[model samples]
Target: MSVALPRIDAIRDAAARIAPHAVVTPVMRNARLDALAGAQLFFKCENLQRGGAFKFRGACNAVWSLSDDEAARGVVTHSSGNHGNALAIAASTRGIPAHVVVPEGAVKAKLEAIEQAGAVLHRCAPNTPAREAAAAEVQRQTGADLVHPYADTRVMAGQGTLVLELLNQAGDLDIIVTPVGGGGLAAGCAIAAHALDSSIQMIAAEPEGADDAAQSLAQGSRIAGITANTICDGLRTLIGESNFEALQQHGTQVVTVSDDEVVAAMKTLWRELKLVIEPSSATVFAAVLKRPEQFAGKRVGLVLTGGNVDLEALPF
Candidate 1:
């Protein structure tokens, strides 16, 4: 069965529309990281973006592009954390109400970020079904358009713009690696990278506890029943049906890393690069470190997905 992928031109259009709201975050390249890892490393620091994650780019694009009539109904989403915050901020910018359904176990800091952006918070069970149910109820009550965190094509294309920016700024990447949860970012990466350079390897990295991306790739089917058991909370989602289609079609590389490895990479970034990256973002860095052979001597781009962390309370 052939699957339809989001159009690269639509993604490019989204990049243009969201240019102001979305930060054109820097591409930080290090000869040292390149030497140590045996590859030229260009890090797309979406970690430093507004709302502390790349979710802002998609949320901004989706929110702004909504018709005045459509936006009048407002927007709602089910997010563990970052997407909720991004949507809230985006809605706030458009002078529209945002209703966010988040899991009970979602980080308090993230919840506060959403609330701070003037969105009403609705809490739900931590599972997929429960989250869908809660979001459905919110949509029924608020008449809000459901802007999904990953599954929405607009959101995926918006996220795809990150790779476009990376390629424009850094250029000529042999491989592109990103952390995958619901696969929004990875699918976006694959579409953009492949469009930019058909032969460029697009890779997805996930924490072992949330390694469904890898399993789904290996099994040649969507893997259900994966538990969210990693410190990379942002990567705790199973790949969505559409995301799987993109990955399968693109033949994207999938890699898994341990929580310990994620932590080590996080520490390395903080210590070596002076960047405070989140666990999910570090998953990609860890993948590169763990499997240097795959990337050695190649020009690699690693999307550092976010930097949202509780600095006041960090795990030593």
Candidate 2:
């Protein structure tokens, strides 16, 4: 079977479909940040979105896109945190059951949020294989559709909608950057950005510890040897196959930032913009800072992917 990647039209449709549910999150700017980065930055604040993350957009789209029978059967997926919570909340909105397989040591606050949204949680080992097995078992038992966090077409299309909204909201941007984990959001952003304006360059920020997307893009194929040991918890996964293909086709650039750099960016975001963002979200800022010459005097748009950080486990 051939792959069915996300398309621009589908992304536009996703924007329309999820409009009522997901926030049209504000685009913020700070003079201090501009001076620091030497770029006019537009921050798409998905941190303020429902579930406190952009994951809600894709999860909502997937849950709602289901046929009546599928929705009735409900949805199942595996996630470290945000996506699971988003899926649980999305299913709750449609009055459908949701089963989430989460790793044993997932974030406390996020796991609590998932449970609070009424999802039945299944615990597994913190590896991809374990999570997949647990989710498959849940789907087998419950007859729920498996909505792989970053690999599903519906999810990728839904993720593209954020860039669609950002381009409309942020005016003319010379560059757009977002953190890449499993590559759903980055791939989606690349598709939408390239479709809207081929001139706009796409960049994906990744943790140095989990630089699979960067390595994959360099090798012209997927590379999966890197064991994730990043503080950017949300960006520790290997890029999905479709996501890698999308990035390769769209000509996206991947920049790797150290965990320390991510932490510094997180602090700057809090101090300069008064926004509480997680380390994964901070990767974009780190990217810009990593290469100030590339972004200088340009209108750069950054997607603040999520803000689901544990207060007690503060890195700064």
Task: Output the number of the lDDT-best candidate.
Answer: 2
Error of 2 at 57 (Å): 0.7
Which candidate number has the best TM-score? 2
lDDT tens string, model 2, 96-194? 999999998899999999999999999999999999999989888989998889998888888899888898898889999999999889888899899
Once superposed on the true structure, which residue ranges of model 2 sit more than 4 Å away at CA? 1-3
Q: List the global CA lDDT of all models.
A: 0.88, 0.91
